[model samples]
Target chain A: MPLLEIRNVTRRFGDFVAVDNISLSIESGEFFTLLGPSGCGKTTILRMIAGFDLPDAGQILLDGQDLAGTPPEKRPVRTVFQSYALFPHMTVAQNVAFPLKMARCSADETRQRLGEALEQVHLTDKAPAYPHELSGGQKQRVALARGLVNRPSILLLDEPLGALDAKLREEMQIELINLQRDVGVTFIFVTHAQVEALALSHRIAVMREGRVEQVDEPARLYAFPKSRFVADFIGHINLLDAQVLEATHGHLRLTIAGLGEMIAPPLAGAAPGGKGTFAIRPEQVRIGIHGEVTELKNHFPGEVTHFLYRGDVTVYKVRLANGMMIEALLPNSAPGGAELFKVGDPVRVGWRHDAGVFLHE
Target chain B: MSDEHANLSPAARLTKWLVSGPPFVFLLLFFVAPSIIMVVASFRYPGEFGGLAPVAAADPATLQGLTLETYRFFFSDFIYTEIFIKSFFVALATTVICLVMAYPLALLIARSPKKSRDLMVLLVILPFASNFLIRVYAWMILLGPQAALSQLVNGVLGAVGAGPVHLLFSPFAVLIAMVYVHLPFMVLPLYTNLEKHDPSLLDAAQDLGANAWRRFWHVTFPLSLPGIFSGSTLVFIPVLGMFAIPDILGGTGDMLIGNLIKEQFLGTRDWPFGSTLSIMLTLAVLLCVWLAARVGSTRGRYA
Candidate 1:
């Protein structure tokens, strides 16, 4: 049985539905993330799971026991809020020790666990410091320590790194991954940042408009998005409007207007002459000078209109002979590192037949 | 500091003084000078007619015609000291009652939706639109005999086999009026502080296994200490020296230090004794503030 199961939960505020009929099953000791934009019901689902809120219609079960009557204090779950939410008047030790204290743990046990939780977050030296005296990253560590001290079966984190700067966020992400690995706690993390969701979660549930769009492992979800929304939401992908020309056993031939026909990996139930989109990651396309032979059969001669230099890789926007724009990302790996293709340079772009996925509708 | 001031342009220097001059001069003239005069007046003897006697460098009244006679008389008797203790108790009771009544109201206003909070706060302050004395009079009427509230109370007492007792012109009436007049002071500061609190803290506490009452005791109440202190100070100080409420609604036994202080000057025409009492009240208020600060700091040190 799954460790936690949310069975068709719905939460509404007056006329507005904050979380509409969402169901999920979470395994033990897996980091799961509800990933979406703001107001997409991700945080609402997290709050319900933490028992701060009750679903209007659903049964949330933990260890196969229905959690309908359980209050937040009685539930064996904790949350690290986005704001850190450390009590301003409390020292770091007091903040971290709160959950243990609430559970009526023995004083000596609380002290032991408090020290262990602080050491886990690398915040041992900051035990005596008040929350206001700590930096943002320190405060975040304190919040994490507080959430972890009680050894809860599930820990909910609501965009805990969203307040951090980019560099600190990256550091925290690595720390969080290691922390989860060490503790082996079932972490139910909620975030709108796709990169963060990808880095920290074993499985990501993409949400849209109070519903789950897709739930899959990070790699699979990134490589094979099921809908236009998922393709646009997860990462940078060029969605070319096309129509299904013909469907073979393992491939579908698609036609882009003003461009030409192309082949994509097979899409189930892609009918002939049906409208769809060929979603391809920019890195999958190869951009090279014209007449430079490439392995890919699908080819287009174009001119580079613009390029964005992103340190590790440069993304070149190619204008095909038909005036259609397609993007190609090439690494800046050569010596004397700079963009190999400048703007207005003639180039050819191509991709393998199976490089992109064809999504109907 | 003088060097820093000297670096400023003439216009800047003049503008600096222009802003601070009025308040500085006002305090010097009205507050500081009157306090000094009162201290001096506390040492002088009362004239045969009224007010202080004429000052003389050497007179038979006592070396320099200014004696410590009023302060000596105050300490020689315990009746004046009893009024001080009674006034302290009344102020303390009023503060406790106001805090108990205002806390929930302030919390409700703070937790209410943003658009409605302004109207709730406005309602708190709306009572101040009427004259303070008129509002005290309104309480007197409510607690008066034959009034609906008094009749209902006495009716309950009658049913309980107890004799009907007076509600008006009693300590209860005076206390009710005091709480009524000063409730806004308690509510406003508390609301202001409670409103600024991040509600996410409570949510986090609840997630960490704190129940509703525990969340309040552990999070909300402690965070509002600044507002509580300020509100208590505002209510306690004004209620300590309040004379009109007791004069209008109080019985003979309901006398507070304020009534005694007033009688020294207005009834007995003893200016020196009045000054002496005012000085004592000032010292007592100072002591109360210091004691509150001490308690607050020590309590806050651990949490």
Candidate 2:
């Protein structure tokens, strides 16, 4: 059995359903993420698991025991809040030791566990300082220590790094991964940033409109998105409205509107007369001034409508002969840091036949 | 401060004075002058009939001495000292009772949804729109012998084998009136402070294994100490010098320092003795304020 199971949970506020009938089963020690935009019910699901909220319909089970009517205090789950809600009145050590004290642990045991918790977050030196005196990063560490002090089986992080600066967020992301590995606790992470979800989670559940669109490993979720929403939401991708001409032998021949025809990978549940979107990542297409090559099964002659120089790579938005715009990215790997292409330059963009995937909308 | 202001242009200085001068002159005239007169008057001897004697009387029979006679007279009697102690206890009791009654109400108003919190706060302040004395009078009718509350209370006492007791014109009535009159002073400050508290802190506490009561005791209460201190001071200071509540609702035995002070000024017309008593009350209030501030600061480090 899964360590935690949310069985057909539904939550409603007034007439609006914040979380529709959804269910998920998480295994022990897995770094699972619920990734979505705001109001996608990601936080609602997390709150339900932490026992801060209840599902109107369905059940939540922890270790195969139904957690109905259990208050947050009795649940073996802790949440690191978005604001890092450390007690302003307590010292770092006291904040970290509160759970142990609540459990009625002996003085020696609390002290030992408190010391270990603080040291785990590298906050041992800040034990005596009050929360207001600590920097934001230190306060976040104290919050983390306090949550982990009692050694809960599962930890829920509600956008814990959302408040940090970009550089510090990167550093803390690494620390969080290492800490999760060391503690071996099931981490249920929630984030709106796709990069954060991809970088941190062992498995990603891409959510949209109170529903999980896909749940898979990061590489698979990125390479083969199941729907246009998943492909558009996860990262930068160009989507084209296509007409499926034929389907046979695990290959679908689709004609993209104004970009000509190409053989796309098998589109599940697609008929020859059906309509769907052809999705390809920006990095998959090769952009240059060279004409069509035989190695490339799909090639288009286009003019560079615009170029975005993002230091390591430049994305060129090219308008094809039929006025369909396609985004292609090329790394700045050539010598001397000069931009190779500018607006109005004629460019040839091509990709292998298998590079693009067909989504059944 | 003068040196810093010297660098300003004439118009700047004029603007500065225009902003600060009114309150400065007002305090000087109304507060500083009266305090100086009272301090000087407290040292003078009383006239034979009532008012103070001449400042420099030549006749030996006339009372014109600048002496500590009132202070000496005050220390020479224990009754006056007893009134101060009784008044202190009443004020302390009122503060504790107000704190207890106001906390839950304040927390409720603070935790209420934002759209309705204004309506709730309006209800708390709505009672204050009426005359204060009229409110005290309203309490009188509620505690009157013929009132249902008194009858119910006396009935409960009678059933318990205790003799029926009067509710009005007693210390209990006086205390009840005092608390009712001063409750808004406690609730407003507490609500303001509690409203500023982040609701997430309580959730964090609960998530860390603290039950409802522990969350309140450990997180909510400690954070509200500032509100408690302000409310306590607001209720304690005014109740210390309050005369009308006791005079209206209390029995003759409920004479506090406020009654004693009032009697000196109005009944005996002993302005010098009244000044001395007023000075003593001032000193006592200052002491209490100093002690409260010290406690607030010492515990306010975390808050």
lDDT of 2 by residue, B142-210 (tens): 999999998999899999999989899999999998899899999999999999999999999999999
Point out where model 2 deviates above 4 Å: A248-250, A267-271, A291-294, A335-338, B1-16, B58-63, B146-164
The 10-residue segment with the lowest total lDDT in model 2 chain A: A286-295
* Candidate 2 second chain TM: 0.94
lDDT of each: 0.91, 0.90
Task: Name the TM-score of candidate 2.
Answer: 0.94
Worst ten-residue run, lDDT, model 1 chain B? B56-65
Local error of candidate 1 at residue A317 (angstroms): 1.1
What's each prediction's TM-score? Answer: 0.93, 0.94
Each candidate's chain A: what TM-score? 0.97, 0.97
The best candidate in terms of TM-score: 2
What is the docking quality class of candidate 2? medium
Stretches > 4 Å off in candidate 1: A290-292, A335-339, B1-16, B57-64, B146-164, B299-303
